[model samples]
Each structure stands twice: as structure tokens, then as C-alpha cells.
Target: MTRALIADANLIKKVQAGEDPIGCVLCNQACLVEDVSNPIISCQLNPDAGYELEPTPKGFFQTRLKPTRLIKNSIVSIVGSGPAGMELAVSLAEAGFEVELFEKDRELGGALRRISNAGVGGVWCRSLTHYLARIENGRIKTFTDNEVLPDDIAQMAERGPLFLATGSVGSSCHSTMSGYHNWISSSDLLKSPLPAHQERVYVLDNKGDHESAWAVETAACFSDEVVLVTADPSPFSRLHKTGDLMPAISRARSLGVKFLTFTEMRAKGDSVEISKRFSPQRELVQDHMVIEVGARESSRLIEVDGNQTRQIFEIGDCFAPRTIQDAIREARCYSRALLELVAT
Candidate 1:
């Protein structure tokens, strides 16, 4: 009748109905059937589910499970709440550790959150929203708009192991001769509204990868003549899969976009000077120029105090620029390593 005793009845019913209930029944108790709908326990055989039941070190659950032991009351501090930091915090909390995540941005999700809101990238926005919801419901604590400095490491070290997952910085072209009225980095372009002009546009693919495609998609929405100029023979070669490249190329083609491979940009009045591979240089006037170069790690925190911190561990783009998948994987591996060290 009650929730605890219902399992017994179910077991007995299963056995009477010509079924082996041994595997189905978890508690080691003899079932006595008083009625088809109800059953009584004749003997309490296994107590504490095959282990000595004791209050965990954290006083959460009374069990000797390995997972519970690895986490009980352990304090973990994670800097940055991007995929890597957030995933690590959630994983640690689920294992029973007290986790606190710090983020510099006003909101979570890092670059993905900001870029996803840009037109034509709504899918990323939706995925990030779903992930943020899970983090909110979990035991992990998030502190936004808090930048972690090197001095902050000492404070976190006193509590538990520290994880640094600061993201990367966008690289922009600082060349003054590159002529264009509007020359903004990809990061800035993704955040701000496009400049007023819907006719001619030029996108410099200095990163030589999927970011080039992203720039093209964004510019295509506003420009009639959008050109993607890249230094690489195959501009999207850095992307891992061909399947991923197909859809982006298809979208650009549908918008009547132009791809200029092995090309470099120079300044020509209010327009851009383009030099194609094995072709004569020509001046092409454009309304906008979006530059998607590359990114470098922002490791200012780690370089403080002449790098005296010995326990310093850098995960995600702060150590090496990488994809979201790589960042999440590194965080998981780092958390597991920390748990193993504490257990021993």
C-alpha cells in the first residue's frame, strides 16, 4: 500500500505470474502475499543495501558509494562559466561537491551566448538557453559579472582545488592602410547592428575557417554584392568535416554571394583593394568590411606574480584556443583528475 512496501507486492505478483523476480527485487527481503494487490515482508534480509550505512563526510547521504566519497563536502571553485567551467561545476556538484562558478560577463554562455543572438545564428542561442536552464536547476552556484584576478586564487585555494577556464581574445587587424569606412572585428560585428548600407560588402577571412562562412552569412542579409576574400586556397579547409561546410556554402550560394580565394585586401579610397590569386589587383568599392581573423588566449591572470602559483591548472581556451567540445572535454578530464587526487 505504501511506497516502500509496493516493491514487495510487485515482486510477489511478478513471481506468482510465472516470472523470476530475483533480478527485479533489489531489497533482500522475503515476500509474503496477503492479497494480489498487497504483500508483506516476512524477514528483512539485507540492511543498508550491501554496505555499511553511515553519514557521508558531507552529511548528505548515508552510504559508502565511491562517487559519494569522492565528493562529500569538498569545495571546488571554477573560474569562467562557459561550457568548460559550467560543465565542470555541474559534474562536481552532482558528485556531491560544493561548487562555485565565476563569470566576468553579465550573463553566462560566454562568446556563444553573445554571438547566438546575432541574426542567422539563432540555433546556437536556443541550445545555450537549454544548457543554462539545466545549470540553474543543478546544485552549482554561479556568480556573474565577477572577474577573477590572480590574487583571487589564494582565496579559492583555501576552500578547495581551483579551475581556471578564462576564454580567448579576438585578434583584429590594426593596419591603418587597409582602407574601408567600417572595419570591425568579427566579435564586434556579431554584437552591434550592421552599418547602414545594403549594397556592396567585403569580408576578410583571415581566420580561414568556419568563421569566414559565419561572416558571409551575416553580411549576406544586408548586402546585394557580398564577397568573402580568403588567403587560403580552400578558405574553409580548417573545418574538420565536409558535411559541415556544405550547408554554409549552400546558404551563401542561395544568397548570390561571391567567394574570392587566395585574396588579400588593401585600401583604395573609401573602397577596398582586392588582389586575387594569380590575378591583377583591382579596387572594389564596398559599404562594409568585416574581418574574422583568429583568437589568442587571455592569460593575464596566470602571468601574475611572475608565475609563482605551482598548483595552477588552465583548462579551455585560456590555455589553448579550441572549440566548445574541446573545452567541455578538458573540464571533465580536469575534474576527474582532481577527484582522483583527493580520493588517494
Candidate 2:
């Protein structure tokens, strides 16, 4: 409806003149947010969201996102072969459309692969294999180690439907702080080799996600004095009733990983300045400082102007730095919409 209003000036005028829009802005209150026990998906705002399929009272629920064989010639260009991009590409390709997938990294699976390799085994890691299998099939034409530039977007836009799923990046304290001989982000630790360090390992848990805890776990295994400093009262607090946080926390504790909650930490040369909530600052000399705060959307799509294109859409982390579920949901919905365009 937002896109329709933008394209059709008369519709925008009608909406301004007290007319109702045709779409929901996906506020993710009832549909997205849910308890671990009852995974029944029902949208409070949009009744049509989960009404297409039979409602399951318990267990994991799947969507009715089957492929629609539309135009065989219409090529869909997808940037980033992550969950969102890969999901979208697979859907479109299965729908009898040619899909060209571009990934900046040499391999596929974006952040999903990174987390999976980080030894954070669970549903997330399992899901990576599923997505990888789907995209690795002969249906999608994938380009690895190819970062899509502005000129590339412009060229692809002229060809056919273009979607941007260029994921996100981990937050670093290097922007604010100085020194700390060895400084690494959560993603850095997850992907690259562990930096050379002695005893002290100070992990700055910023966002308090599962990734932070897993990174802390990895750090704890190597370093003797592993201290997790976080602003949140509890790490991985966002993972409501997932039954993942508590066990991981317990394991980290067993591994001698100390927790310092409600604290702010910054790197200062050879030492790190740590301050508790409403407390005076104290510097702790550490050999390694790993910062795991949060992630920001990749600016690849933002920098590239796709206005001149026929149909351009951005889904996943490129759209907003949300969960894997949110990215997959958005991709599925948008792909359905684009399929309609091909049908017309």
C-alpha cells in the first residue's frame, strides 16, 4: 500500500482525503513476538496473515508459501545470498523464474553460516543447512565473492525485478574508544581466528543476543579470566522462553566465565575502563577485548538508488536489523507480491 501510494499520486490523494490504505505496516506485536511453548502464528492487525493455512495448536508451524509458475523469462536479481535473499531466490526460481543471486562473501549463508560455524548449534544452525540446500540447487544462478556495486544495481534494475537482502554488521567500540592491542567484534570472533591473547578476556555484551553469549562461551574456553561486561541485567534476555539462554549461561559459568551486569565498558590503551551502573569507573588491564553489542543494516542498498528501476525491493537486515524469522517472513511476502506483477 505504501508503494502503491507512492506510485499512484491519485491514491495518495485519496488516502490523504481520509481513505484507508490497503496494507498493514507489520508492527510485529502479535504475529512475530510469541512464547516458546505456543508457536501459533496469528496477526492481531492483519487477519489474513496466518488465515491461509490450518492453525497448529502446538509445534513448529510452516507458511503456505508455494511457488507460482508465472513468467519463465522474467529474471529476478537478488543481492546477498543470506537467509532472506536465498529464501526469496529459491521461492522465485521454484516459481519458474530465473534468479541471479549475488554474494559479497566467497561462500553463501551470510550471518547464518557464521553463527553455525561459531558452534552455536540449535535451530539457527540447522536452518542454515536447509537454506543452503535450497539455493545450491541448479535453479538459482549464484555469484560468490561479488560485491554488488551501485553500477551493478543500475544495470540489474534495467533487466528485471531486483531485491536487496544485503544483511548487517556487528557493532564495535573502536569508534568510541582507543587502544586495546587486540580488539575484535562478535562477527570477527565468529568468522576469523581468535586473536593472540594471554589470560584476561573482557567481552562487552552490548545487544545481549544469543550470538553474544555464544561468543563469550568461545572466549571462555581459551582465556582463563573471561569477564562478560553487559549493560543488560541478563545476557540473551531477548530470547524469550527459547530455553537456550539459561543453559548457555550455566555452561559459560561452569567454564569460569564471570558476568558483570548493568555495566558500561570501553577500551583505554592497554587497559579497559569498566563502570558499573551508578558507580565510579575502574580500569581493568586485559589481554583481549571482544565486543558483541548489536548489528546495523548494510548500507549497500541505501547507497544505490533504484528509483529508475521498474520494481526494486529491499528485505531482511538490509531493510531492518531484525531476526532470521522476520527476514524470511518479509522475503516470502515480498516474493509473493512480485510474483503477482509477473502474472500481470
Top-lDDT structure, candidate number: 2
Cα lDDT over the full model 2: 0.64
lDDT of 1 by residue, 1-344 (tens): 33234333456676679853222122222233324564433322111221223322322111212243434555678888776777677667766688888988788887667656544344455546655765787788889989888778877755655678777655433543244556766655643567676667777776654456677777777777887877787655554332345566677788888888888776667876677767786756555655554523354476523224433456777778765555665666665555544565
Alpha carbon lDDT of residue 325, candidate 1? 50
Residue pairs that clash (backbone atoms under 3 angstroms), model 1:
179-267
Across residues 179-283, which tens digit of lDDT does each residue of candidate 2 receive?
Answer: 556666665565456666548777777666667777777786677788888788886666544556776677788888888888887767776677888778675
Name the runs in model 1 displaced over 4 angstroms. Answer: 1-74, 118-130, 147-154, 172-183, 187-201, 206-210, 219-225, 233-242, 253-256, 266-273, 280-290, 302-308
TM-score of 1: 0.62
